[model samples]
Target: MSALPVIDIHTGAAPVLRETVLEFDQVAVQLGGRQILSPTSLKIGRGEFITIIGPSGCGKTTLLRAAAGFVRPEGGAVLRQGRLVGGPSREVAFVFQDYAHALLPWRTVQGNVELALEAAQVPATERAPRAQQVLQTVGLAAHAAKFPAQLSGGMQQRVQIARCLAQQPELMMMDEPFGALDAMTREGLQDELARLVRETGLTVLFVTHDLEEAIYLADRVVALRANPTAERPSLARVIDVNLPRPREQLATKEHPEFLRLRRELYGYLGHGHG
Candidate 1:
């Protein structure tokens, strides 16, 4: 008997040179005497939105961290734009789930965003316009002068996102960014993120435990299994979302494909108990 073929869900658009923005070549990780991730191989094309979903301790965030060069894999390699990733770079921006801690409380919204540009050493004269432009993109232009403590949870997250955008990164690593928000806020931010990614053509690798959220925003969803072995690898499945774009929170979730994907992924994560 032979092993089953790995399912690849593609949007059906041919990529030029099939350009790969990120690749994990048989990557493996161990942390504090535990195997966090087994050897896994994956590729992300330029401008593609790839979401990672799995049960707790399944290495979703670890994978994202490896891509960001925050974690070193014990075996194999991670590549960005075909070059070996050494450490964190300006070209890759990370958005944490805790927006409260991620944003500097004392800094005004614009001031916080300005930090990215300042780190990149953009001339002082050019920083404000760039920050404002990104703030406008994320619908935070009007709140530029407000402090993080003055804003709601969702708006604070937007400020963090705006700061990342100010860096003009080619790739964004988001770890459960909307996980802390209320349902309505999460849905709104999902749509907003989808729009921004479309407009900017930025490649993203998002981590989430929410199956529906994974299917909703991803061009492709990568499902992982925690305890990987030779027979059952860490990369359990790769599902392509064929749902229509500009997805609506109400209508899109009601779509047949959406329901089917939700059910399929639920089996992997055992989602119905709660």
Candidate 2:
């Protein structure tokens, strides 16, 4: 396995804390006889928001799935809170990009959130209040009684997120959760998600194709490459984003560091330069 570089522009910034919540130790994966991910190693600290960005088919989603225990790695291991991830657990909740299909069409928004509790076998008596509280956090309490089809795309996505929050998970794996929404809605949810993560203190491994979104939401960004060999691994770069918190969409994007990081990681996304 090749060594992956961690670029840190913040000399005076805080170092990654010691309380590691997730570790990908030389993890490798193959799908249908093709190596999807080469040996990749990373340690995600507790409450850290790490975003994965790479070109399409660069194993971004595969890596996230491996960490979530949905895809078993062919080599190495994925550990959560110092334990090997055997399979998907209630403690690690996954949010899909396709909100339209993720929710049960027949159920109300409240019922959708409660589905998490139901799947976990959380007591039937406890589901409604717990689901309602989560809905409030995602700003969907007023719409909870409505069905999924009754809400807008963004609202349905919020319902999906609220369901994950209802799970009360320690870790969240979001695979481009806002990729399908319109730009305005996407930006709105990005801020909402950042706040939700802050309030919940949940560790997140989010996958996205948008370079700006990746940098805006991540404490550290992980870049990957496709078609790896022994000399060239799938993992490319891990960069620390030292921008100040309470990031505003307009102001934060204009910040110098944000632009610099965007340019630095821009090549990895395989898009035209700045």
Runs off by more than 4 Å, candidate 2: 1-16, 272-274
Error of 1 at 133 (Å): 0.8
User: Residue 184 CA error for candidate 2 (Å)?
Assistant: 0.5
lDDT of 2 at 9: 22
lDDT of 1 by residue, 1-274 (tens): 1121222333445433446788999998888987788889988887788999887877888999999999999999999878889999999999999999999998999999999999999999999999999999999999999999999999999999999999999999999999999999999999999999988989999998788899999888999887765566788889878777778898989999999998888886686311
TM-score of 1: 0.92
Backbone clash pairs for candidate 2 read: none
Residue pairs with backbone atoms closer than 3 Å in model 1 (clashes)? none
Candidate 2 lDDT, tens digit per residue, 1-274?
1222333323334443347788999999999988889899998877789999887887888998898898999999998878899998889989999999999999999999999999999999999999989999999989989999999999999999999998889999999999999999999999999999888889899998889999999989998876777578989989989887878999999999999998889855566311
**Per-model TM-score versus the true fold:** 0.92, 0.93
Models, CA RMSD each: 4.1, 3.6
Least well predicted 10-residue stretch by lDDT in candidate 2: 1-10
